[model samples]
Target: MANHDTETTEKLEKFGKRLKELRKAKGYENYEQFAFKNNISRSQYGRYEKGQDIRFSSICKVLKALDVTFEEFFKGFD
Candidate 1:
């Protein structure tokens, strides 16, 4: 159980890193600006970037806002 928890934490952190990477690539240096522009909850998006859990539908919205397909967003993740 401990190992599983660790693995989950690692995955979440990686996901957050990927999100930040994409956001920066899209020319938004500030997460707040990105969230505000996309009509997402800025605090929630900040939590997401800090590796907090997120809902599937919310992630889909984020992906759409980032102009990335599911496949593209998950490309390098395992």
Candidate 2:
């Protein structure tokens, strides 16, 4: 059970990092540019990608900004 939880947490961290990288790879320069491109506030979006526990409402908004469904973000997880 602990192992499963650890794996899920690790996967979330990886996803968060991947999102940050994608912003860079997409040539957005920084969070400010990325958020601006997606019409989100930079500081707030930073909190979204920080991989910390956040409200579902904020999560949904962030997912919308990322242009991904929950299934897409969570992929192989059940």
Candidate 3:
């Protein structure tokens, strides 16, 4: 349903925003630097931080690179 799609999109965007904030807090000024340091593709990481859909496995990898636990990553989710 359209509503479901909208909800998913909203959740993804919120997650992306949170990811960006966390990255900044870790002193990563650019996505390329973060991705490179984490062994992720820079373009893919950019997309992830831009609210685009990303794979769950990739999300896990990013969380690991950020030194964040799953619970910490999903904190404040509604």
What lDDT score belongs to each candidate, Candidate 1 first? 0.91, 0.68, 0.90
> Worst 10-residue stretch by lDDT in candidate 1?
1-10
Across 1-78, the per-residue lDDT of candidate 1 in tens digits comes to 133487898988898899999999999999999999999999999988887898899999999999999999899788
Model 3 steric clash pairs: none
Taking the tens digit of each residue's C-alpha lDDT, what string does model 3 give over 1-78? 133487898998898998999999999999899999889999989989988878889999999999999899898899
Residues 11-72, model 2: lDDT tens digits: 66676676686567567777888788877777777765665445678667767776777887
Higher-scoring candidate on TM-score, 1 or 3: 1
> lDDT-based ranking, best first?
1, 3, 2
- Winner by TM-score: 1
Model 1's number of clashes is: 0
Off by over 4 Å in 2: 1-12, 22-27
TM-score of each: 0.92, 0.59, 0.92
Error at 27, model 3, angstroms: 0.5
Q: What is the lDDT of residue 10 in candidate 1?
A: 90
Q: How large is the C-alpha RMSD of every model relative to the true structure? A: 2.7, 4.6, 2.7
